[model samples]
Target: MDIPRSFTIRESTHRIHNPLDDAKLAVLGRALRPAPGWSVLDLACGSGEMLCTWARDHGTTGTGVDLSATFLASARARAAELGVADRVEFVHADASGHVADEPVDVAACVGATWIGDGVPGTVELLRRSLRPGGLLLIGHPFWRLDPPDQAAVEGSHATGRDDFLPLPDLLAQFGALGCDVVEMVLADQDSWDRYVAAQWLNTRRWLDENPEDELAPVLRAELTDAPVRYARYQREYLGWGVFALMDR
Candidate 1:
């Protein structure tokens, strides 16, 4: 099956697929309080940064699943680099309808809840793989402030087409999915800068290679114009975070 080409390309770069920073990731790892024997199933686990870090810091064991072969390779390489290769496995597979091969202490879908439709469906799907009282860490976007207009809205990278909710509604959606919010770690503007600005670097490189390519124009313009608008909209008016959940 074909995955989103942008996502696969983003994975090949080793930066986060979303606007997250080391501080935010540290918060996520600490929020879970992973233990030596604890196992975490990181669904749609991008480059496996969280898994590798958790294993190194907490001795946690886990598997990370993603559709991108490129991402899985990076995750494996990172696991080895962190000396956690034995503790984590990176699997290349579609995670939309997946379950853990074995029950885990944590089941997470960070920045990719769309794998199961949205927060509700994703939490339900992940819950099946979680042990009773186990933790589930889901990363998603929220509004820092209400958008001023459709232009402001588009600048934040949200589409009129998707079913994104505000933070309050997102939290409520989690509750509706049969989970209680136990903890959360939000990404500040600096974190957003890391995510959005890095894309400029990526897009610039892509443009340099495919100068005459049609899509390059739109992407190049997005790269040039996005930073200012993104900082104004997403960084100033929208926030994103990872939340810890449990079966209620």
Candidate 2:
């Protein structure tokens, strides 16, 4: 079985499969207030950077699940490098249907809410893996200001049939799921630039090393103009954030 190419390639090259920034991660870790030895689940965990970092910094145990074998391998290597192999484990499996074997103190679906339909459904699914009153943190995009065009809509991860909710709608969904939005941190324009620009550089580096690879053309196309696209649409129109929710 293979995960989507875009995600797998990005994971192998960038160590992050999703479009989250460091500022967002820090905000999430803080919002969850992850205590030492807490059990955590990271769904669609990419290369498991956030999970490994949290395990190391907070003395927690984490189990991360993803569909990408490449990402799972990378996660394993990262765990070993961080000397947290014993504290964290990664599984190569379908994230959308996977569940923790046991309840956890924290459950997260950062940048992968689509796994459970959307933010609301994903929130409910993640909560099933959390103990009563436990935390569920999610990373999602919002609009700094409402978009005015098709390019803006595409850049924001919003399109027809995929209704991306604004921040207030997100909070309401949290409420519907019987959770309270306790904390949130927004990704500013600089952070947005960092996230997008980093992708271009990483893609270019990969292309440079593998000039004959099948993906070289795709990488070239992206490298040629990703920065411009980001500056015009994504960085300009979208606001991304990591939000922490708890039992109301």
Cα shift from native, residue 120, model 2 (Å): 1.7
Report every candidate's CA lDDT: 0.81, 0.78
* lDDT digits (tens) for residues 14-118 of candidate 2: 565555665567556766678999999999888898888888778889999988888888899999998999999988888887778889998988888889988
Model 1, TM vs. native: 0.91
What range of 10 consecutive residues in model 2 has the weakest lDDT sum? 7-16
Per-candidate TM-scores read: 0.91, 0.90
lDDT of 1: 0.81
Candidate 2 Cα errors over 4 Å, as ranges = 11-13
Give lDDT for model 2. 0.78
